[model samples]
Target: MKQLLEILGFIALVQGVAGLVHEFTDWDWGFVQRLDVLDGYEVYASVALLVLGCALLAAAESRASR
Candidate 1:
């Protein structure tokens, strides 16, 4: 369970970082306009997932430590 949570957290963290970069650096969004809404949503989702995954990982780790 701990390992699973850690893996999920890592995945979410990485994905969130990617989404954040995409939101900030992607050029298409600046010009295309549609990328704005799409990337914004992706960023939000990724951030939420990241938080949830990290929480799960922490809970699992705490349980394992016990």
Candidate 2:
């Protein structure tokens, strides 16, 4: 369970960073930018993903210390 959280967190973090980078640099990358539903809200979605990733990682760490 902890491992799963860690893995998910890592993926989210990567994607979030990628999304932000793409938005700022026009790099043409990341899954967030490719979503039609998030046409004008990619930045917000990326920020949410970044926060979720941090939360998941923190949860995994707490679980590990248990």
Candidate 3:
């Protein structure tokens, strides 16, 4: 479970980074402007996933330590 969570976190982080790249390359709107409606969503979701995954991994680790 811990390993799974870690993997998920890594995936999320990578996806978030990709989203950021997409947003940066998008010229339809200026940076920090309307980005949230576009690729920014990916960033947000991926960040959330990463945080959740990390937390899960931490919990698993703690449990294993017991």
Best by lDDT, which number? 2
Model 1 lDDT per residue over 7-46, tens place: 8777767666666666678733222224446554776765
Which 10 consecutive positions of candidate 1 have the poorest summed lDDT? 27-36
Compared with the true structure, all predictions reach lDDT values of: 0.66, 0.96, 0.56
TM-score of each: 0.66, 0.97, 0.47
The TM-score of candidate 2 is: 0.97
| Backbone steric clashes in candidate 1, count | 0
Residue-level lDDT tens digits of model 2 in 1-66: 999999999999999999999999999989999999999999999999999999999999999999
Clashes of each: 0, 0, 0
lDDT of 3 by residue, 1-66 (tens): 667766665665555555456556753422323444644365565456556656766776786776
Q: Where is model 1 more than 4 Å wrong at Cα? A: 27-40
lDDT of 3: 0.56
Index of the highest-TM-score prediction: 2
- The C-alpha RMSD of each candidate to the native structure, in angstroms, is 5.4, 0.5, 6.4
Q: What residue pairs are clashing in model 2?
A: none
In angstroms, the error of model 1 at 59 is 1.7
